[model samples]
Target: MSNESNLQVTFSKHCNGLFKKASELCTLCGAYIALIVFSPSEKIVISQVPPQNSGPMQFIEANRSAKLRELNAMLTQINDALDIGKKRENELSDLRKKNETQFWWACPIEGMDRVQLQLLKKALLDLKKRIGQHANMVVSQGTPTQTFPFFVGNGSSSNMPIEH
Candidate 1:
Protein backbone atom coordinates (compact mmCIF):
# COMPACT_ATOMS: atom_id res chain seq x y z
CA MET A 1 0.00 0.00 0.00
CA SER A 2 2.82 2.39 1.00
CA ASN A 3 6.38 2.87 -0.37
CA GLU A 4 7.96 1.23 2.74
CA SER A 5 5.79 -1.87 2.28
CA ASN A 6 6.59 -1.95 -1.43
CA LEU A 7 10.28 -1.77 -0.68
CA GLN A 8 9.98 -4.56 1.88
CA VAL A 9 8.20 -6.80 -0.63
CA THR A 10 10.86 -6.13 -3.27
CA PHE A 11 13.61 -6.86 -0.74
CA SER A 12 11.96 -10.08 0.37
CA LYS A 13 11.72 -11.25 -3.23
CA HIS A 14 15.42 -10.51 -3.76
CA CYS A 15 16.40 -12.42 -0.60
CA ASN A 16 14.40 -15.46 -1.71
CA GLY A 17 16.74 -15.95 -4.68
CA LEU A 18 19.87 -15.33 -2.57
CA PHE A 19 18.80 -17.84 0.10
CA LYS A 20 17.90 -20.43 -2.54
CA LYS A 21 21.38 -20.21 -4.12
CA ALA A 22 23.08 -20.23 -0.71
CA SER A 23 21.18 -23.41 0.22
CA GLU A 24 22.24 -25.06 -3.03
CA LEU A 25 25.89 -24.14 -2.39
CA CYS A 26 25.74 -25.61 1.09
CA THR A 27 24.23 -28.85 -0.19
CA LEU A 28 26.81 -29.28 -2.99
CA CYS A 29 29.83 -28.43 -0.81
CA GLY A 30 28.65 -30.66 2.10
CA ALA A 31 29.14 -27.55 4.23
CA TYR A 32 26.59 -25.78 6.38
CA ILE A 33 26.24 -22.03 6.18
CA ALA A 34 25.09 -19.68 8.91
CA LEU A 35 24.26 -16.35 7.36
CA ILE A 36 23.13 -13.01 8.77
CA VAL A 37 21.95 -10.58 6.13
CA PHE A 38 20.78 -6.99 6.41
CA SER A 39 18.74 -4.84 4.06
CA PRO A 40 19.36 -1.22 3.13
CA SER A 41 16.42 -0.32 5.36
CA GLU A 42 18.17 -2.07 8.32
CA LYS A 43 15.99 -5.19 8.36
CA ILE A 44 17.99 -8.26 9.45
CA VAL A 45 17.50 -11.91 8.42
CA ILE A 46 19.37 -14.90 9.83
CA SER A 47 19.53 -18.30 8.12
CA GLN A 48 21.21 -21.56 9.10
CA VAL A 49 21.35 -24.83 7.17
CA PRO A 50 19.89 -27.86 8.97
CA PRO A 51 22.11 -30.73 10.20
CA GLN A 52 23.47 -32.83 7.35
CA ASN A 53 23.80 -36.65 7.08
CA SER A 54 27.00 -36.09 9.08
CA GLY A 55 26.71 -34.59 12.56
CA PRO A 56 26.40 -30.81 13.11
CA MET A 57 29.25 -30.83 15.65
CA GLN A 58 31.72 -32.08 13.04
CA PHE A 59 30.65 -29.38 10.61
CA ILE A 60 30.94 -26.67 13.29
CA GLU A 61 34.41 -27.87 14.38
CA ALA A 62 35.65 -27.91 10.76
CA ASN A 63 34.33 -24.38 10.25
CA ARG A 64 35.97 -23.23 13.46
CA SER A 65 39.36 -24.69 12.49
CA ALA A 66 39.18 -23.12 9.01
CA LYS A 67 38.29 -19.71 10.50
CA LEU A 68 41.11 -20.03 13.06
CA ARG A 69 43.63 -20.67 10.29
CA GLU A 70 42.38 -17.66 8.32
CA LEU A 71 42.57 -15.43 11.43
CA ASN A 72 46.12 -16.64 12.23
CA ALA A 73 47.29 -15.83 8.68
CA MET A 74 45.75 -12.35 8.89
CA LEU A 75 47.44 -11.74 12.26
CA THR A 76 50.80 -12.83 10.84
CA GLN A 77 50.44 -10.40 7.92
CA ILE A 78 49.51 -7.54 10.28
CA ASN A 79 52.54 -8.29 12.49
CA ASP A 80 54.82 -8.28 9.47
CA ALA A 81 53.41 -4.91 8.34
CA LEU A 82 53.87 -3.44 11.82
CA ASP A 83 57.49 -4.63 12.00
CA ILE A 84 58.24 -3.09 8.60
CA GLY A 85 56.67 0.22 9.63
CA LYS A 86 58.70 0.26 12.89
CA LYS A 87 61.96 -0.37 11.03
CA ARG A 88 61.18 2.40 8.53
CA GLU A 89 60.32 4.79 11.38
CA ASN A 90 63.64 4.00 13.10
CA GLU A 91 65.56 4.57 9.87
CA LEU A 92 63.81 7.91 9.28
CA SER A 93 64.54 9.02 12.85
CA ASP A 94 68.21 8.14 12.46
CA LEU A 95 68.39 10.04 9.19
CA ARG A 96 66.76 13.10 10.79
CA LYS A 97 69.21 13.03 13.72
CA LYS A 98 72.15 12.73 11.33
CA ASN A 99 70.86 15.61 9.22
CA GLU A 100 70.43 17.83 12.32
CA THR A 101 73.95 17.09 13.50
CA GLN A 102 75.44 17.92 10.07
CA PHE A 103 73.94 21.42 9.95
CA TRP A 104 76.32 24.45 10.58
CA TRP A 105 73.61 26.57 12.21
CA ALA A 106 72.83 23.76 14.66
CA CYS A 107 76.12 24.49 16.49
CA PRO A 108 76.75 27.43 18.84
CA ILE A 109 77.11 30.38 16.43
CA GLU A 110 78.29 32.54 19.37
CA GLY A 111 81.80 31.02 19.20
CA MET A 112 82.19 32.12 15.56
CA ASP A 113 83.71 35.52 14.46
CA ARG A 114 81.71 38.50 15.72
CA VAL A 115 81.12 39.95 12.22
CA GLN A 116 79.94 36.62 10.80
CA LEU A 117 77.69 35.94 13.78
CA GLN A 118 76.24 39.46 13.61
CA LEU A 119 75.42 39.04 9.91
CA LEU A 120 73.81 35.69 10.57
CA LYS A 121 71.80 37.13 13.49
CA LYS A 122 70.58 40.06 11.42
CA ALA A 123 69.58 37.79 8.52
CA LEU A 124 67.70 35.50 10.92
CA LEU A 125 65.87 38.46 12.53
CA ASP A 126 64.77 39.87 9.17
CA LEU A 127 63.52 36.47 8.06
CA LYS A 128 61.55 36.11 11.31
CA LYS A 129 59.92 39.54 10.93
CA ARG A 130 58.94 38.88 7.30
CA ILE A 131 57.39 35.53 8.20
CA GLY A 132 55.44 37.02 11.09
CA GLN A 133 54.09 39.82 8.91
CA HIS A 134 53.02 37.31 6.22
CA ALA A 135 51.28 35.12 8.81
CA ASN A 136 49.41 38.10 10.27
CA MET A 137 48.28 39.18 6.83
CA VAL A 138 46.96 35.69 6.04
CA VAL A 139 45.14 35.45 9.36
CA SER A 140 43.48 38.82 8.96
CA GLN A 141 42.48 38.22 5.32
CA GLY A 142 41.49 34.50 5.50
CA THR A 143 39.47 34.36 8.72
CA PRO A 144 36.16 35.44 7.13
CA THR A 145 36.34 32.65 4.52
CA GLN A 146 37.51 29.84 6.85
CA THR A 147 36.75 29.06 10.50
CA PHE A 148 40.15 27.53 11.33
CA PRO A 149 43.14 29.63 12.46
CA PHE A 150 46.26 29.11 10.31
CA PHE A 151 49.47 30.73 11.59
CA VAL A 152 52.98 30.39 10.12
CA GLY A 153 56.16 31.19 12.01
CA ASN A 154 59.96 31.46 11.46
CA GLY A 155 61.93 28.35 10.42
CA SER A 156 65.11 28.63 12.52
CA SER A 157 64.86 25.03 13.76
CA SER A 158 63.47 21.83 12.27
CA ASN A 159 62.03 20.93 15.68
CA MET A 160 59.63 23.84 15.37
CA PRO A 161 56.26 23.17 13.63
CA ILE A 162 56.71 25.63 10.75
CA GLU A 163 59.02 24.97 7.78
CA HIS A 164 60.34 27.70 5.48
Candidate 2:
Protein backbone atom coordinates (compact mmCIF):
# COMPACT_ATOMS: atom_id res chain seq x y z
CA MET A 1 0.00 0.00 0.00
CA SER A 2 1.07 3.56 -0.62
CA ASN A 3 0.33 7.04 0.63
CA GLU A 4 0.83 10.28 -1.32
CA SER A 5 -2.82 11.18 -1.59
CA ASN A 6 -4.11 7.82 -2.76
CA LEU A 7 -7.00 9.17 -4.83
CA GLN A 8 -6.84 6.32 -7.34
CA VAL A 9 -9.74 3.89 -7.52
CA THR A 10 -7.52 0.78 -7.67
CA PHE A 11 -5.47 1.84 -4.68
CA SER A 12 -8.53 2.63 -2.60
CA LYS A 13 -10.12 -0.65 -3.57
CA HIS A 14 -7.00 -2.56 -2.55
CA CYS A 15 -6.87 -0.73 0.75
CA ASN A 16 -10.50 -1.51 1.39
CA GLY A 17 -9.96 -5.17 0.52
CA LEU A 18 -6.99 -5.41 2.88
CA PHE A 19 -9.01 -3.85 5.68
CA LYS A 20 -11.94 -6.15 4.96
CA LYS A 21 -9.83 -9.27 5.31
CA ALA A 22 -8.31 -7.88 8.46
CA SER A 23 -11.79 -7.22 9.80
CA GLU A 24 -12.94 -10.75 9.03
CA LEU A 25 -10.00 -12.19 10.91
CA CYS A 26 -10.52 -9.91 13.88
CA THR A 27 -14.17 -10.74 14.09
CA LEU A 28 -13.69 -14.47 13.74
CA CYS A 29 -10.74 -15.04 16.06
CA GLY A 30 -10.07 -11.78 17.91
CA ALA A 31 -7.09 -10.59 15.85
CA TYR A 32 -6.24 -7.05 14.75
CA ILE A 33 -3.79 -5.24 12.51
CA ALA A 34 -1.54 -2.20 12.46
CA LEU A 35 -1.05 -1.25 8.84
CA ILE A 36 1.54 1.19 7.64
CA VAL A 37 1.66 2.21 3.99
CA PHE A 38 4.37 4.26 2.38
CA SER A 39 4.20 5.96 -0.98
CA PRO A 40 6.95 6.23 -3.55
CA SER A 41 6.44 9.97 -3.38
CA GLU A 42 7.67 10.42 0.19
CA LYS A 43 4.62 10.03 2.38
CA ILE A 44 3.42 7.52 4.94
CA VAL A 45 0.03 6.35 6.13
CA ILE A 46 -0.66 4.38 9.29
CA SER A 47 -3.90 2.57 10.02
CA GLN A 48 -4.78 0.60 13.13
CA VAL A 49 -7.87 -1.14 14.44
CA PRO A 50 -9.30 -2.91 17.46
CA PRO A 51 -11.66 -5.85 17.97
CA GLN A 52 -15.33 -5.26 17.19
CA ASN A 53 -18.76 -6.79 17.36
CA SER A 54 -19.58 -7.94 13.82
CA GLY A 55 -22.14 -10.14 12.13
CA PRO A 56 -21.43 -12.91 9.59
CA MET A 57 -18.28 -12.19 7.58
CA GLN A 58 -19.93 -10.55 4.55
CA PHE A 59 -18.66 -7.53 2.60
CA ILE A 60 -21.15 -4.91 3.75
CA GLU A 61 -21.24 -6.15 7.32
CA ALA A 62 -17.48 -6.56 7.47
CA ASN A 63 -16.86 -3.15 5.94
CA ARG A 64 -19.14 -1.43 8.43
CA SER A 65 -17.62 -3.33 11.35
CA ALA A 66 -14.08 -2.69 10.16
CA LYS A 67 -14.77 1.03 9.74
CA LEU A 68 -16.17 1.15 13.25
CA ARG A 69 -13.12 -0.66 14.64
CA GLU A 70 -10.78 1.78 12.95
CA LEU A 71 -12.73 4.74 14.24
CA ASN A 72 -12.79 3.25 17.73
CA ALA A 73 -9.04 2.89 17.82
CA MET A 74 -8.58 6.43 16.59
CA LEU A 75 -10.90 7.85 19.20
CA THR A 76 -9.32 5.70 21.91
CA GLN A 77 -5.89 7.15 21.17
CA ILE A 78 -7.23 10.70 21.27
CA ASN A 79 -8.91 10.04 24.61
CA ASP A 80 -5.80 8.44 26.04
CA ALA A 81 -3.65 11.39 25.00
CA LEU A 82 -6.04 13.88 26.56
CA ASP A 83 -6.21 11.85 29.77
CA ILE A 84 -2.42 11.64 30.03
CA GLY A 85 -2.01 15.33 29.31
CA LYS A 86 -4.55 16.20 31.98
CA LYS A 87 -2.96 13.79 34.45
CA ARG A 88 0.51 15.24 33.93
CA GLU A 89 -0.88 18.75 34.16
CA ASN A 90 -2.60 17.86 37.41
CA GLU A 91 0.57 16.25 38.77
CA LEU A 92 2.68 19.28 37.95
CA SER A 93 0.03 21.55 39.46
CA ASP A 94 0.04 19.46 42.63
CA LEU A 95 3.83 19.58 42.81
CA ARG A 96 3.77 23.35 42.43
CA LYS A 97 1.19 23.58 45.20
CA LYS A 98 3.33 21.49 47.50
CA ASN A 99 6.39 23.55 46.66
CA GLU A 100 4.45 26.71 47.49
CA THR A 101 3.46 25.24 50.84
CA GLN A 102 7.09 24.59 51.63
CA PHE A 103 8.36 27.79 50.06
CA TRP A 104 5.40 30.12 50.21
CA TRP A 105 7.29 32.82 48.34
CA ALA A 106 8.53 30.49 45.56
CA CYS A 107 6.56 28.66 42.86
CA PRO A 108 6.60 28.08 39.15
CA ILE A 109 5.89 31.31 37.27
CA GLU A 110 4.85 29.78 33.98
CA GLY A 111 1.33 30.76 32.77
CA MET A 112 1.70 33.86 34.92
CA ASP A 113 1.73 37.45 33.79
CA ARG A 114 4.79 39.63 34.24
CA VAL A 115 3.22 41.36 37.21
CA GLN A 116 2.62 38.09 38.99
CA LEU A 117 6.11 36.76 38.35
CA GLN A 118 7.62 40.03 39.56
CA LEU A 119 5.45 39.90 42.64
CA LEU A 120 6.63 36.39 43.39
CA LYS A 121 10.28 37.30 42.89
CA LYS A 122 10.01 40.35 45.12
CA ALA A 123 8.19 38.36 47.77
CA LEU A 124 10.92 35.70 47.70
CA LEU A 125 13.69 38.27 47.91
CA ASP A 126 12.05 39.92 50.92
CA LEU A 127 11.54 36.54 52.54
CA LYS A 128 15.21 35.71 51.99
CA LYS A 129 16.32 38.97 53.58
CA ARG A 130 14.01 38.46 56.55
CA ILE A 131 15.25 34.88 56.99
CA GLY A 132 18.85 36.01 56.78
CA GLN A 133 18.26 38.33 59.73
CA HIS A 134 16.42 35.55 61.53
CA ALA A 135 19.37 33.26 60.81
CA ASN A 136 21.77 35.77 62.29
CA MET A 137 19.58 36.06 65.39
CA VAL A 138 19.48 32.28 65.76
CA VAL A 139 23.26 32.02 65.31
CA SER A 140 23.87 34.68 67.94
CA GLN A 141 21.61 32.73 70.31
CA GLY A 142 23.48 29.46 69.43
CA THR A 143 20.32 27.67 68.18
CA PRO A 144 20.05 25.12 65.39
CA THR A 145 19.80 26.77 61.95
CA GLN A 146 18.05 23.64 60.65
CA THR A 147 14.77 24.94 62.07
CA PHE A 148 14.77 27.75 59.50
CA PRO A 149 13.47 26.76 56.06
CA PHE A 150 15.85 27.11 53.13
CA PHE A 151 14.60 29.28 50.24
CA VAL A 152 16.27 28.05 47.08
CA GLY A 153 14.57 29.68 44.10
CA ASN A 154 16.78 29.11 41.10
CA GLY A 155 17.21 31.18 37.92
CA SER A 156 17.52 34.95 37.40
CA SER A 157 14.72 37.29 38.37
CA SER A 158 14.42 38.21 34.70
CA ASN A 159 12.39 35.07 34.12
CA MET A 160 9.91 36.71 31.80
CA PRO A 161 10.72 39.35 29.19
CA ILE A 162 9.18 42.69 30.03
CA GLU A 163 7.38 44.60 27.31
CA HIS A 164 7.60 48.34 26.80
lDDT top scorer: 1
Can you list the residue pairs that collide in candidate 1?
Answer: none
**Model 1: per-residue lDDT, tens digit, 55-117?**
655676688899999999999999999999999999998886676455434446654466546
The digit string of per-residue lDDT tens for model 2 on 1-164 reads: 36446555556677778878877677776667788876445377677866665545455577878999999999999999999999999999999888765543455556555765776777568667877898788889998655544333333343333111
- TM-score per prediction, in order, is 0.36, 0.32
| Candidate 1: C-alpha lDDT | 0.68
Question: RMSD in angstroms, candidate 1?
Answer: 21.5
lDDT of 2 at 62: 71
Q: After superposition, which runs of candidate 2 have C-alpha atoms over 4 Å from their true positions?
A: 1-57, 108-164
Worst 10 residues of 2 by lDDT: 155-164
